[model samples]
Target: MTSTPGNSTEKRQFHGDLIQLRGDRAAKAIWRRVPLASAGSENSIDEVALQEMLFRHADILALGEIDPAYRNSVPVCMELGTRAGAADALYLTPTGRIVLAEFKLWRNPEARREVVGQILDYARVLGSWSYDDLDREVRNRTQRSPCDIVSEAHSEVEEHIFIDNVARRLKRGEFLLLIIGDGIREGVRDIVAYVQEHSGLRFNLALIEAAVFRRGDGEDLIIQPRVLARTELVPRTVLVRKTILEETDDDPLEEHEPSPIEDENERFWRAVLEDFAFDDPEPEVPQPSRYGSVWVKVDGSGFGGWGLSFGAFLNRSQSGMGIYFTWRTGFPEEERVFDEIVGALSSNEELGSRLEGWKRWSAPSGPPRLGFSRNVEFVDGTTIRDFDEAVGWMREKFNRLVSVLHPECWRRLRAKG
Candidate 1:
């Protein structure tokens, strides 16, 4: 990320309050930072609780945002016993990449450095193992059945291929390392510099901030995960062949340095986020859907527990805005309201004209989409102004959508919900 005149990059942040609406009750929840320490008895969010919270909500790690290919990831185990010590959490992606995460609440500079060292040590120790060794350790530590270990997370991976891939990764010292803290406050430049100084190490590193917002009763919780910081990009790795040499039925390899096309995609989204400015009735503060997310939740707000977002799609070839018929599959009445809204939008002349050139794409296996969109291209020589113009178009149209649908249509639906 180089600096240019008049092109300052803002520190990415999750904006707005956590508003919860349950059973027609709308209670605005504030962004409550995790407490430092309890005054008396003991700390409420001890290290154990933090780990449990993270383990329970793996989405907090934002692995999908890091790499779209990591979609079907699953936690392998917690407190994975390593030669150095027990790492807080471990995950396995469908692509056979091992994601090791460690939880830390760093108050001082020294604690930050120590945590970085600990994470490196964990990665180093884990890097030095045979497939049998890694599998045996996972089997011994994990409460889940040994047979379900790889099959559950990645059913497509045969046991032999899974076994061989792990062995190869161990030999190559290739791993994705994460140093997670509760609402990271320190400047990321310093942590990135520290990781950069230790470039000899063979793993990609990232800094994540996991912010937890809870309701009064604590039963309802929302975790806003921010990649908050990143040190470097990992070479995109895909599950291709069992091994490079001695080809059998498998393809040779699906490994390569990150391509320029991907770099273009990331850069385009970053520009849109920085230049986002809405008009008319101001909505809630918007935030990136996730780390390296291609889209943003422009609505920054939702009614009936549904969000309206606008983002680049199809490798930046298309972009649009839409919200799903949320909570529709379960509660029949709520689904009715959402379905009615979708149906009304299609027939309502005023709303239908505004939605011209929009698309609602759906698949049998995936949720149905209801969006306003246009085809776009990010080919060679695409400028920052081009990115800004796209966002401006989205912003203007979104504002119009809000003005039309918000109070009249959305409020009515909210009342029914």
Candidate 2:
């Protein structure tokens, strides 16, 4: 491979052309043949610009080519925590496949290796989280729900399915780690291989080299990204390791064995139900949801069979109560009843004012409801006196709501015809 001084220039061009040929050779050659428009030199591009460009045009990463149904999202908690360190960019697929990425200039070998370990650590932290926690964190950090973020980009995605997929994938440790940079040097693949060899079922790592060229001195930057190394095969075996203080994998809405806090929650709600019985001795008995939320149906006066209900909940994190209007029929009749009931309650100044500060929920799978919750510092270890105070608080709120709504309810009955 000896070359004369004149041949040295040709040798460099040949090597550059080989890299270009792997992707779009025609475009690369045409751009190379022309002089780039620039008032000054084009060597000052930084990593921030690279990160922003990739985030805006994530499809450029070609994630869908791997799985046609897969879509991308930017999680606000990409840095994970102080222990896992921060990542440059993060993405998730439709089926909950995580794509962790870092953008570097790749001029430094040590920095590149460090990013690989950093992203891997993020995966370990993510393993302990459920979709609910991630969704809540995403909303807290971005001021937008994770569901809304994904739906904005992929309008066709179903919310429940998307969320379910994320839980499944995180539990299984199925993720893709991309290390993207400009001017990637040699020996990076060896580093990826060594890490991949010892790694388990969590993630597959890849390297992409982005070559940025200027079209004219204008802001027309042309970026050509080529995959230096493809993603490694994910293991079929699932490896799940829960974070120390995370929720159990069981669905919170389903019935499960009662915990200590659940027992206390049940006792408190039972006393409240007895107070409710002073008016209607045979009112439906309250039962506990999987997370120990006590709920039962109450008469809606003119609504007939369609009842109003309340739920009292307790958990290690917080405790709360909710008032719901259960739908008796299909969507058309249900909506009519909801409007009528809400309107009556709102017309009563006392009842409507009390309902303020409550949160509302209208999901497809269940009836519409309003809820109020308070953080609990000691859920499982609350004193019996505390439970008595909770029962009294709920009883007072319930009596006030029912008393004020009674007159408005009669008005609703007269208008129903």
In terms of lDDT, which candidate is strongest?
Answer: 1
lDDT of 1 by residue, 1-417 (tens): 884654434333344556556665765545454443323424245556767878766766777776665555577888888889988887776556677888887555577778888888887787666544566667778765322564765555533334445545655566778887764655554767677654444567878876766655455566677786665643323334653232222222322232343345346445444656544344443443211223333232344344443333332212322222232244455445445657777788877677565556652332355555554545552322356676666555555554444444445545655
- Runs off by more than 4 Å, candidate 2: 1-42, 65-82, 236-417
What are the per-residue Cα lDDT tens digits for candidate 2 across 1-417? 675655432221111322234264455422321222222435556677767788777877766554444445544334433236656666765445667777775544577677777767776666556665566556655676666766665665545445556766666566777788775555677777787666654466778777666543546666767776755565533234742222334323222234443355556666776736424343454543223344444454324534444444444322344333344445454446557767744576666676665446663435565545454345433434466676676676554444443344445544655
Residue 198: error of model 2 in Å?
A: 0.7
Q: By TM-score, how accurate is candidate 1? A: 0.49
The models' CA-based lDDT, in order, is: 0.56, 0.55
Native RMSD of candidate 1 (Å): 20.7
Worst lDDT run of 10 residues, candidate 1, spans 315-324
lDDT (Cα, 0-100) at 200 in candidate 2: 53
Q: Which ten residues in a row have the lowest lDDT in candidate 2?
A: 9-18
lDDT of 2 at 197: 65
The TM-score, computed over Cα atoms with residue i paired to residue i, of candidate 2 is 0.49
Give per-model TM-scores.
0.49, 0.49
